[model samples]
Target: MHSSLNDHMTLLKEIAEFLNEETEMETMLQGALKKLLTRSVFASGWIFFIDGKGKHKLIAAENLPPALMENDCRSMKRGGCWCVSRYHNGELQKASNIIECQRIEQARRQSEKSSGEITHHATVPLQSGKEKFGLLNVATPNTIEYDQSELALLESIAFQIGSAIKRIHLTRQEQEIALVQERNRLARDLHDSVNQLLFSVTLTSRGAMEMTEDMELRDAFHDIHQLTQEALTEMRALIWQLRPKGLETGLLEGIKGYAEMLGIHVVTHVSGVIQLPSRIEETIFRIVQEGLNNIRKHAGTNQAELFLTVNSTDVLVILKDDGRGFHAGKIPGTLASVGMQSMRERAQAVEGTIEWISAPSEGTEVFVRIPY
Candidate 1:
């Protein structure tokens, strides 16, 4: 009993962690149902989420028979081992023996078999405010009894999941609003900054050409014009970074450019066909740039290698420098450094990842991966 209780506590803790981390309702519910199965409490469980059209869809399930997983939720009949009907029309429901629950009379009637038994199920109606969100159903051979502690844990998970879903929905809305505002702000700033500065420099150069008789001064004016153009280029890059979802530039262009850089000899080997979204392209380029620059600035190694390979469903980008590598744990979290934090955030935003493979004598390596 002691061991079992400890295991149960651990499961609840894990459930709480998952609820806290999961922002999407479908994902949270799906994860909760699965976590519950980790213990012997519920032999099997599945979650059905109501869709926008008021249709109940079994979006996720745990401990489902392998055969049933491939098919639609509606296909499962009363004999199904574990199924949760996310029906919000009712309140907290507990059926010791699903076979005894008269609620599934239709399933009994539909089956012309020797035994007309409804599976034992315990369902807790999930609700957020007045609206019914979904159902969490677990099925077992016998009356699956849950005490106050168990029910409380499940209810707590339900509440946490509900809150997370709510928070995510609000966050999504706020982000959308912020994006619109940011777009307008960037537009205004672009006009006031880069465009104006470039236009003034161009006109000034023209005026100087027409009025100045000294060739040396004219040359100097041309130099100023060149420098202003370079600044304009940087401005364009900044704007590009601000709105990086533009995948049109392609990863090929970025890699080729990196190869041309003098200090960072990014020996690259790319094969097959690969494509990425604009956000991904920009992130890879920046990560590569930062990694190489770090090596140049910190690592005393003279060599670096960059490799790219594309496969169905995902793309991989690797950049490594054969210089002294520092311990990843020892690294400080400060923007004052280089691009470490930016690289991490960018990878996470796309559901991708980066690994820093360097320690002491080992060279530094930055790896990036993203779903295609």
Candidate 2:
């Protein structure tokens, strides 16, 4: 018994040391799982990460059965597990006997063809204080029951895992918030200094154009005025993209303002009220900005239409322009070359989808669908 206690203590120390190292969430979880397997008697284990949207994502797993891993672990990814459902429903707060493993039961039903041995598992909610991150599940092939000490050890590991996850999440949130704050500061500076200066230059150049009588001087002044005006337009677009003030009012209003700044007439159609998470809102705004930038640079038209339909589940955004369009198949170069890749990435960051459709001489269209 003393040896067993020493082993548990050593396991706890090792987990503490492993988690303290600079490692990503996945790596930390996997490393912890490896340590747990070495120190304990569990045959297999996995971790579910609950995201901001309250969706459970299976981030790490080890020694999972073939049936479960089939189809990209569709069953686990779909959140059909008994332990996860209990965790979501606030039933399983601490490590204890909850329900039989659904994967094991399914395998038992198909025992004739099942490949690996299965056994009952224990699950513990990984949480820091009141913030629940997810669940840690462990199972052994043998039919041995856990003692109080074993359960306590598992709970301690779960606590460490939860604390590490919370730290990682808070750090990421801080980084993202800092980035947004910096972007806002830069946008303000540009609007106050560069944007104002450009506007003044445009007005001064136009005044010179009107006052100059010589043809050459008048033409020179006119060119300068047009250049300044174009520069101001581009600068305004950049400022809006960096920090959209209109988003404070509404997404559609912000987008309309941006389009107008680019000298593009936008016809907006809205169906439902616009309500979304801030990250999703930022992604949609960036996507629209990229689309408008492409229109100004390549579309060769000053008219565009934006359609937004929001529902409880998702938001649909379609931006169409009647411009000199190119063939979608032969997109001159990579999608990154035309900013489509960045837009696609932003959409994907929110578990959204974006598509582009265009044909030579026919208008171009950008479609985006994001879940709230």
Candidate 3:
């Protein structure tokens, strides 16, 4: 009994240390799973997290059955086993022995083609307070019942994992709010100070030009007026990019406003449902901004078109322009030219794809598809 108590204490300490590390959600889950599998009696384990769309996402798993891992675990994702359904329905409040998993049974029936087997398992819902994040399932080869102490230990581990996840989520939300606040403050300062000052300078220069009789003096005033106007235009664009006011309405409207600021005529079309996750919305906005900037600086065209199509699972965006396009093959292979590469990285961060099609003297098209 003393040995068992010492073992449990050691495991708890390890878990506490792991949770304190600042890491991403996936890495934290994977680390927790590995620690549990090594310290507990379970032969294998997996974690299923429910996303905002109420879909079960298998975030981390270790020593999983060969059959389940086959074809990238399509069966688990598509069908969803009994444990996941029970947890989602609020029926699984604690660790309990599952006589058999239907998923494993199905695989066993086709055992001639698969590689691994498990007869029974235990599942515990990972919850913090009243919120349920997901479930943790551990499997064993034989149908062995767990004692009270063993079940209690599993429940404790699940609770710790859930609390860690909640804490990380709250931290991220706070950071985002702080960032937005700072951006808005900067935008306000620029509009009230620098932007107004430039406008006044432009007016003063024009008045001076009209009053001057000397041709050279008039020319100097004209140049000052033009320079002030250009600076004001650039400042406005920067402020809009920092904090887009139209974004409160929708992404499309925000992009339209930005394009107008850049002196580009943008025709936009939307089809299907226009809902998107916040991260996806931000990524799309950045991509559009970059696309329009490229058109103004390099494309030398005044007209562009944007198309957005949304469905239950993904959002597609296409931005096209009839401008003096460059050779796509000539894309610089360095981070110094961050136009195309930055867009591609943003798309990839959301598990999405981006394509660029362009040719000299023709036109350019940027296609992006993101799955939520």
For TM-score, the strongest prediction is 2
Better of 1 and 2 by lDDT: 2
The reply for model 1, stretches above 4 Å from the true place, is 1-160, 206-211, 244-314, 318-341, 348-366
> Sort by lDDT, best first: what order?
3, 2, 1
**Each model's lDDT:** 0.62, 0.83, 0.85
TM-score list, all predictions: 0.42, 0.88, 0.82
Write candidate 3's Cα lDDT for 1-372 as tens digits: 788778877897898789879469989989988998899777788888876455688888888777867668665667767787777777889999887888777666654555355767798988789988988888866645677777888898898999999999899999999998999999999999999999999999999999999999999999999999989988998898789869889998899999999899999989997788788999999888888878877788989999999998899999999988777878733431487888889899998999888888888999999988
Shift in Å, residue 9, candidate 2: 1.9
Residue 18 error, candidate 3, Å? 3.2
Q: Residue 61 in candidate 3 has what lDDT?
A: 87
Clashes of each: 7, 0, 0
Q: In angstroms, how far off is 138's CA in candidate 1?
A: 13
